[model samples]
Target: MLSWLAEQRIQEAMRNGEFADLPGHGKPLELEDLSGVPEELRMSFKIMKNAGILPEELTLRAECVTLEELLAACRNSGNANSSEQKSLESKLSLKRLRLQQLLRERGLENSSIFTEYGDQIRQRLSGQE
Candidate 1:
């Protein structure tokens, strides 16, 4: 009932030209590029972005960068135990895979980072142990 009343008021206002002469009245709305957002989450993410929130995939990408840094540190550390270093490397590889999956889900399968990480993983699997 309230929605009907509100819509009626909006229609009346439109009839009165209340929305006319507004900014961009004769122009098309400038829409943001949401091609990287998943179809189901696109609307939710738009609202979240309007409220100054980052999307989950972006946060996951940040985590991937941190993990990559930690893995590099382990690789360069003389005092790091081989087993511990290997564990961190494994975790980093898994995180990269997860990030790639997220990117693929969001229609970013062609993203450079995804391609790079995916290629690395494939190359590692194809190499002789």
Candidate 2:
């Protein structure tokens, strides 16, 4: 009964052009790739994403990537200031350490598959891949 009423309302809104000017109205929706997330936790992950909250590990990983990019740019620049390069490198190292610690806490560090692909994971996270 409730669904029928909700659908009726939606249909009425469509007829009234209430949805016509909504963002991305004519375009295909950009779906998030949640294949890597476990099925049981997918809903929680989606809710957090919609709320603009990122998992801690992801935040740390992103920081590491940004720091690495900054470090690379510093190295490639004409000035090549040693102090600035060192600071960025230090921050990157800290972020990577925190990420590793988080993975270890989650028991992901010792998994056989993770062990095998650890280098690849690191490379990808560091934006090398």
Candidate 3:
């Protein structure tokens, strides 16, 4: 019964684009239609997607970094070849560094939040378990 409910929800989410999934591969979440979530929360999801989960085609190495770190990384990863992206990357690097420092200061650097960044990012940023 519960599984059926879960499946129904998944189907509904699929229709609504509220949830996205990859099967045996990384598929970019179609976040364009997602609504209700705050803008910052949505950004967190992008960070989660970039750092840990690569789009199935890219297959970037899996990472374990907080959403902030991922966001920072994404900002830094602004396609170096693109001048505009390079500028964004520079900004991201600075923000990423600051978050890293914050994590260290809070002593959460070595904690599960940092160690399990990818998973936590998925859960927290995506509002999923």
Candidate 4:
């Protein structure tokens, strides 16, 4: 009953042009890949994402990427500033350590798949993939 009333309201709004000229009105929606997320948790993940929340592992990985980029810039610039490079290296190391601890807490650190391709997985998580 409520759905029917909602649909009628939506139809009335459409007829009134309330949905016209909206952003991305005619564009394809950019859907996120949820294959990695378990079916039972997909809706919760989507709701969190819509609310601008990210899982801690993802957040740590993003920080690692940014730190790596800064370190690369420091090295490639040929300035060879040891302090700045060391600082970035230290930060990257700490973030990686924290990420590893998180994965260990989740029991993924000892998984055979993770052990076999840990570097590759880290690279992918850091957006190198």
Query: Which stretches of model 1 miss by more than 4 angstroms?
Result: 1-46, 49-53, 111-129
Q: Once model 3 is optimally superposed onto the true structure by TM-score, how far is the C-alpha of residue 101 displaced, in angstroms?
A: 0.5
Of 1 and 3, the candidate ranking higher by lDDT: 1
* Model 1 quality (TM-score): 0.45
Q: Pick the candidate with the highest lDDT.
A: 4
Residue 128 error, candidate 2, Å: 8.1
lDDT per residue as tens, model 1, 27-101? 999988666444566788789989999766565565666666677787788887788777877877787788778
Of 1 and 3, which scores higher on TM-score?
1
* lDDT over C-alpha atoms for residue 11 of model 2: 100
TM-score of 3: 0.32
lDDT of 1: 0.70
For candidate 4, the TM-score is 0.67
lDDT of each: 0.70, 0.78, 0.51, 0.79
Candidate rank order under TM-score: 4, 2, 1, 3
lDDT for each residue of candidate 3 in 1-129, tens digit (9 for 90 to 100): 999999999999889866445463455555453343334445765676778854321121122223335555556764534655556556656655665675567565666534454344346544475
Tens-place lDDT digits, model 4, residues 46-128: 99889999877767877887888889899999677999899999999999999999988977766664443445546776677
**Sliding window of 10 residues with minimal summed lDDT for model 2:** 113-122
Segments in model 4 whose C-alpha atoms lie over 4 Å from true places: 1-18, 38-41, 110-129
